[model samples]
Target: MEIVASVTNASKQYKTGDTVITALQPTTCEFKKNELTLIIGPSGSGKTTLLSLLGCVIFPTRGEVTICNQRIDGLKQKELANVRLKNIGFVFQSFNLLAPLNALENVMQPLLLLGISSKEAKQRAEEALRKVNMENRMLNLPKMLSGGQQQRVAIARALVTNPSLMLCDEPTAALDIKSVAVVMEELKVLSTTGKSVAVVTHDLRLKQFADRIIYVNNGVASENPTEEELFH
Candidate 1:
């Protein structure tokens, strides 16, 4: 019912030498609250470009991006980073956790960067790990955990900030089949907690868990596509 993010006629272009490559065509869409949305496409289909634009990793060449009622496309680097820190959470294909740090410390890192006190960050990190069912492994280093556990820690790190939007890029790509299933289940549970979740993945196995699917093709996006349409 709530609109967590919206892109109004957004498009992205990159200029290399004399060539201008358009990554995404003008598009408008809304990512709703408490829903798990998937942006699916093959390599070079603009899925990553679109995700980058939506996640505030990159701005559009034209149009607007509004997240939690704030326009992000035009924000200065620091301002954009602040908006992303406060409103958006990102998870990547790789777990991206430091090998030396334990799960709790990894989750606490962002909170500390946000100026949250050490004690408070620890408390918040513990709570976040619990949410992802990783409380039992909070003290374990990344090397000691399985791939799924590491991914869950990565997710907890994202959630610890209490951001309204969570963006993931091919989060399950590096996992085994069973780990992928577990991670997908955890992501589904996270979506139910009022956060807007959008993942850009080319993995068809995870498509069954999505509430809505956005198909990107040749730099254009089509929403609510059928599985048959996307797989072929």
Candidate 2:
């Protein structure tokens, strides 16, 4: 498989007045094209830290990060923002949809922000909603929908950007079993489109759908873990 993004000897550290904390250990890893990869670990084990670095949201303190073979760790803030807008889509755990907007409106916001016309944004947003089986809920407000429904809308919003990489953080943490299954299956389908899908999840129930499992612990990254290591 082709590598969509990679970190080479990358690590992150935070410095206080007199103390330094290592959020992630030096490690090299690749996120492959058209694959569903899970980064699993206990809380505070640097799973999200690695995601942020790979997504170009935060630069690594040491080493290099590349997406599609372009080095990004040394990029300026403006350049980084451009890269993220063009290549990365984020799905937050909180389902951060605006309460005032209906489902279609929520999904179109990002496209509009990217300077797409209202008509075109609406068209693309509608198609994205259809992908997640959410077209019927396009007119419903967040308060009127179930948690699963809201998450589907969030997924539609992420897809509207046509991003090469989807960085999902705790996507199923608050979802019920039924909802988790629906969302995971939907996510699995997305991986067939030649995009890179990386999920940071604590839910072991979703591991069966992953093509690769990356275990993060105490700022370390272990790739291709056995099923036993992932679930137990």
Candidate 3:
């Protein structure tokens, strides 16, 4: 398993009137390719902050992050954005789909922005939606779909580009058990097909999907050897 993403002594801090809050302490970690890893911790423990750093959404206040062998800290903002758009896929807790666009159009947006021809973009989008078994719902708007269906559409949008890394933040937060299982099953299939998936979640119920588990506490991380606990 080659290292796909690495964080070396990373930290994020913020300053208020008279005090400085350290949102992340100096932390080091690495994620390998073709594995599903879980970032589990209580609220405010920096799980999301770490994901942002790894995803290149924000630079660290200190230390370095490397993605696909490129040092993100050295890149300019524009360069970083390009790298993020091309190499990373993000699944937000809110199911960030455009309400007005149908499922196929929403999935096609990324390819279109990358300058792919409209015809090619639609072709790829249809293939992605089909991967998640949502081809039948291709023309449904976000509001017309159930929560689980909407989330599957969002997943297809993220996977359409076949990104090197997939970052999912609380992906199953509000879903019922059945819907949660549906999403987790799809993610499991994704990881098996060779894309690296990292999930930031508090829902232990989904832990079984993780090939590796890293528990974050007070901005630090430690390996969870009891990953089998997920199945038990």
Candidate 4:
């Protein structure tokens, strides 16, 4: 398998006046193509911080973050943004769709930001929606779609970019059982198609879909956690 993204001895810290808080400890991990890796932990467990590091949303205070084999920890903000645009896709718990835009338009937003022409963006967005079984609802607004349908559209938006790595945060948190199954199945299938899928989630039901699991707690991360470490 090929590594699409990785963090080596990466750690994060925040300064609040005279106080310094550590969000993540120095840790190393890799996310590979054609695999689904789950980052699981309880609330305030540093999983989200780990995800943010992989997503290039923040610079690691120490160590390195590589996406598509490019070292991004030292890049300027504009350069980091460009890297994210070209190599990464993000899915949030809140769907993050535009209330006023229809599904197709929402999916097209990323391509449009990349300066792709409307015609090309539309064609690609349609294909992405089709992949997630949302082609029929392309014209519906977020307000008009069910929670599951909206999530599918969000997936399409992420897929439209054809990114090497997909980072999802609490993707199934807001979903019901059926919707969770549908979303997780979609992500699992995507991984098999040669994209690295990393999800930060609390939902244990998603474990069945994972090819690998990363457990995090108290700012520490382990690639292979023990049963006691995972539950205690």
Candidate 5:
């Protein structure tokens, strides 16, 4: 499988006055195309930090982050933003759709930001919504949609970019069982279509959909965590 994104000896830290807090320890991991990888851990674990690193939302204090084989850790903010817009897609637990925008408009926002023409953005957004089974709700505003529907719209927005890596942070956290199943299945299918999908989630039931599992605890990451390490 092709490596869409990777972190080598990457770590994150925050300095609060005189104290330094480590959010993530040095860790190396690769997300590959055609795979669904789950980063699982309890609250306060470093999973979210790791996801942020992969998403290029934050720079690693030390070490490197590579997306589509380009090193990003040393890039300027504008350059990093451009890289993210081109190579990465992000799905947040909150859906993050603009309340005033209808489904299609929200999905069209990313492309519009890239200076794509309205006609082309609309065409691509429609196709993306169709992929997530949200075509019927194209004109509905976020307030009018159910949580699941809004999430589907968000997924469509992410997919509209045709990014190589999709970083989802607790995507299923706010969903009910049926909705969770629908969303996870959609993501799993997406992975098989040459996109690398990495999900940071706390739902153990989601393990069934994972092609690879990474466990994080106390700022440490383990590719093959023991049963005790996962549960206790």
Candidate 6:
């Protein structure tokens, strides 16, 4: 499979007066295209930080990040923003939809910002909703939907852009088993459609769907042991 993202000796540190906290230690990893990988770790283990760096939301204090063969770490803010807008799709744990907009409108926001005509954006948005099997809820506002329904809309929004990579942070954390299964199924289908999908999750129930698993501890990551390791 093609490599979608590569990180080498990446680290992030924050200063607090005389003290400095290293949020992420030197780490190297790569995510492959059309794979669903899980980054599993406890809180404050740099899971979200790693996702931020991968998505170009925040630059690493040291080392390099290459996405799709491009050296993204050294790019200017404007260039990074453009890269993210075009190549990265984000699904937050808290379904970040606009309360004022209905499901369809929320899904169209990205296409709209990309300069697509409103009519075209709406048509594509409907198609995305259909992909998530949420076409019937397209006219409903976020307030009118359940947690799983809202997340389905968020997934549709992320997929509508046809991004090269999708970053999901604790997507199943706030959900029950039924909702988690629903969301994971949608994510699996989304990954099958050719996008590299990476999720930072603590739910072991979702591990079976991952092509690869990275277990993070104390701000560092390592390849997780197989299911045999859990029972042995």
TM-scores vs. true structure, each candidate: 0.97, 0.96, 0.95, 0.98, 0.98, 0.95
Tens digit per residue, CA lDDT, model 4, 132-189:
9998899999999989889999999998999999999999898889999999999999
Candidate 2 or 6, higher TM-score?
2
Clash tally, candidates in order: 0, 0, 0, 0, 0, 0
Model 3: residues with Cα > 4 Å off, grouped in runs: 225-232
How well does candidate 3 score on lDDT at residue 151? Answer: 88
Worst 10 residues of 3 by lDDT: 223-232
Ranking by lDDT: 5, 4, 1, 2, 6, 3
- Give stretches of model 5 more than 4 Å off: none
Q: Point out the worst 10-residue segment of candidate 1 by lDDT.
A: 223-232
Evaluated at residue 61, the lDDT of candidate 5 is 95
Residue by residue across 1-232, what tens digits does model 3's lDDT show?
8888999999998789989988889988898888899998878988999999999988999999999999999899999999998988899888999999999999999999899999999999999999989999999999999888888899999998889889999999967889899988998889877788999998777677989888887777777736553333
Worst 10 residues of 5 by lDDT: 223-232
User: For residue 125, what is the lDDT in candidate 5?
Assistant: 99
| C-alpha lDDT score of every prediction, in listed order | 0.92, 0.91, 0.89, 0.93, 0.94, 0.89
| Residue-level lDDT for 3 in candidate 2 | 90
* Candidate 6 per-residue lDDT over residues 92-211, each given as its tens digit: 999999999999999999999999999999999999999999999999999999998999999999989889899999988878889999999999888888889999987777888898
Candidate 5 C-alpha lDDT tens digits along 73-180:
779999999999999999999999999999999999999999999999999999999999999999999999988889999999998999999999999999989999
Instruction: Give the 10-residue window scoring lowest on summed lDDT in candidate 2.
Output: 223-232
User: By TM-score, how accurate is candidate 2?
Assistant: 0.96
Highest lDDT scorer: 5
Clashing pairs in 4: none
Residue pairs with backbone atoms closer than 3 Å in model 1 (clashes): none
**lDDT tens digits, residue span 74-176, model 1:** 6899999999999988899998998899999999999999999999999999999999899999999999999889999999999999999999999999899
